[model samples]
Target chain A: MEQILRYRVQNDFSALSRFLEELRGLPGYARLNERQAYRLGLVLEEMISNIIKYGYDDSKVHEIEVVIRWGDMKITVELSDDGHPFDPMRHHCPGSNSAEPLEQRPIGGLGIHLARQMSEEMTYRRENGRNILQIQIGGGVAGD
Target chain B: MEIGFEMKDKMTIVHLQGRLDAETSPAAESQLLPRLSASGGNWLVDLKDLEFISSAGLRVFLMLAKRARECGTKLTLCSLRPGVRNVFEISGFCTIFAIEDSPAGI
Candidate 1:
């Protein structure tokens, strides 16, 4: 089975909520034991939030274009936004392991790291003044 | 996001439900951080019903843990669903925070 969702959502939390609900309502989403589906939601939410929070230079509301392809074996997410040009894949500090002491660790950056770690694969690009991120989760696997 | 504060015996248990993401984390931090500093540093957060947690949510928990250590109080997170637990595992947080099967098991 295959499903695709393409929609433009405002930079708001309600948009994130609405997108999640749509993902949950897919044809075979419920049959797959929501954990994998929830992983999709979490990855999408984190990536989009970063675009909305840091991608824009001004406070003006922008539309983030999201394309989700729900396939039989895996789920692919392609998120594009008209915010600033930044690559979530390359901008953050590299080689920061999760083994740092709690006191020495920074509170931030873990979100993007989690988004990177959970997905089976992820790619980022900057094209035509937009930031694009693609993420893949749940590759022929059920549950955690 | 909904947070309920419960006084269980001598420990303060913070009950969290719904999604703890970028949108709801600031409020969660404001409500959760102050209590950890009030001399009772021993804390238990019940995350059984917390369906989703983003990195923003991790920051709140991390902040609480860092502060609790300075104050010499313990923080135990219990009843985490597998999905939520996976977030902790990947982040290597299992080594930093005390996690148990249930609040009673803690």
Candidate 2:
């Protein structure tokens, strides 16, 4: 069996927060520790925010599909967006390992790099004109 | 996430409650940056109620600290939760920044 939650909302930030809260209550997410859960929420928010701001080019409404599955020892979260197909993993992350001053440095594309650093395994692919990204989280008790 | 401010003479105290993820970090950054300009050499960040934080959230802290340093003000974090503390340790921020178990100690 699989758990799925789909959302269609305006390019608003509140919708992302509500979607993350829903994931926190899922059975599959119950196994993750606070750190993993928080990281997962951050990754999801960053991806969604990028799509909302840059993917749709200010489109009024965007649809996102989130599918979660509980494996024997791992939890998989897949997020698919119908906005533009952009792979964040390949984006150039500014201020990466730099000693530049904060005001001088631009806040460019660091979210994706941060997400990759926190997740145990992360993959991104474009399928059916949608960006499909999956993350595997473990290192906790088994799901009840 | 809820952010409350307390003015301690010239020092500013920011209390962060709830989870500070990518979504909430921007709010923190926006609220904290402008306050740093008037800080009289000290800013205390109270994270006692913060249950969890990710890299995205941590970035906000780093940015604040960097800005404070440039302005000759100090940014100190107090009362970090265990999970949030672990993120600091992993990021090697524990040594670079001043962190205490409680605000009273800071």
Candidate 3:
């Protein structure tokens, strides 16, 4: 059987924290190995934090929808935000010039890069004025 | 996240416990940034008990490293869990910061 978890969070850090807490209480979360779970959490945090910090233009409150499907040795997370249209897949990844000095290195792109690196697959698209990002990670279920 | 520190001779060891994400990163930065001395010194961050970290946390560490460089202070990170290690490696932080298995040698 598959376990699907859905969550709605505001465009704020505290909401993200609460959503993560709720996620950890689910049975599907217990099936994940330490590494898989960590990657999932990291990806969610990176994506949500990015949307909260940069996805919005006005001071109005917005809601982000998160859906997670777990089973079949895989876990997929989908995040939908009604903020501006931004594609994480097209975002730049920094640290390409590893030899560059620290002062010259830019810090803006590392979050998206790390999120992309942690997941097996990531896709982004704009639909109905909403930005939808889907991330999938394989081999999520742990063995006894 | 709980931040604690211990001074040992010329080296100061800082212990980080709990999650370091967007929610806690601002407080972590406020506490950690002020601890970096303008004078030269050695510092080690122990992450054995740190359960989680995201890009927000990584940004704080990067800022700390930059400040340490400007102050002529030595900064090191030690005892990272496997998950945290993966994050550092992916972000190329493993090359930028001095990381070790433990605080025994350095």
Candidate 4:
């Protein structure tokens, strides 16, 4: 059996708050084990915040779509937005500079990296002025 | 997430309570950055109560670390929960911050 939860949100942080509530309350979210749930939440927040912050050139409002599909084997999340076509995966993960010590390491450059690191697989596509991202994670449905 | 600040023996101790992901990081950044700028003293971050963190939170600590280095100040992160520590280790942040097993040693 397959189960899904979908959300349509404005390009505002307030929308994110509501979306998070729904995600947490999703029927089977509790059975996903702690790590997978955390990943889903982290990816959702990171991607949507990027869209809300950089998705538009003007102050006008826009909408973003989030869909989560889960079953016994794996969980998949899809995010689509009507904003500019920016691929989160294109950015490189600059290696942390452990040699120079913590103080010298750069401040930025970890959001997309963590998103990539968390998901087992990810794909991105652009069409008709919309950007879509899909990610797959987890193994068997057994609780941890 | 709640953020508390205290001065302990020349170290500016920034104690984080609760998750430090995207949702809470903005609040954390707004509260912590100003203090970070004014602080050239050593830093001991107490993360015993923090259970989660994402890149957004990582960026905040990194900013402080980089700035402190530029200012020749000291920074240390201590008492991370296993889950939060994994986020840092996964992001390779474990190597980027001076980490200790407990806050008492710092």
Best by lDDT: 3
Q: Pick the TM-score winner.
A: 3
Ordered list by lDDT, greatest first: 3, 1, 4, 2
Total backbone clashes of candidate 1, pairs 3 or more residues apart or in separate chains: 0
Off by over 4 Å in 1: A21-32, A93-96, A142-144, B39-41
- Candidate 4: lDDT of A133? 94
Candidate 2 residue pairs in backbone clash: none
Residue range B1-106, candidate 2, lDDT tens digits = 8989888877789888988775678888888788787666588999999977765677787778777888898888999887778667655567658998898986
Question: What is the model-wide C-alpha lDDT for candidate 3?
Answer: 0.86
How high is the DockQ of candidate 1? 0.66
Give TM-score, chain B, model 1.
0.94
Report the C-alpha lDDT of model 4 over A106-133, residue by residue, as the tens digit: 6656667777877889999997889999
Share of true Cα-Cα contacts across chains kept by each model:
0.74, 0.21, 0.62, 0.50
lDDT of each: 0.81, 0.72, 0.86, 0.80
- Candidate 3 chain A TM is 0.89
Error of 1 at A115 (Å): 0.7
- After superposition, the stretches of candidate 4 with alpha carbons farther than 4 Å from their true spots are A25-27, A93-106, A139-144, B36-41
Question: Candidate 1, after superposition: displacement of residue B93 in Å?
Answer: 1.5
Model-by-model DockQ, in order: 0.66, 0.37, 0.65, 0.46
lDDT for model 1:
0.81
- Quick one: ranking by TM-score, best first? 3, 1, 4, 2
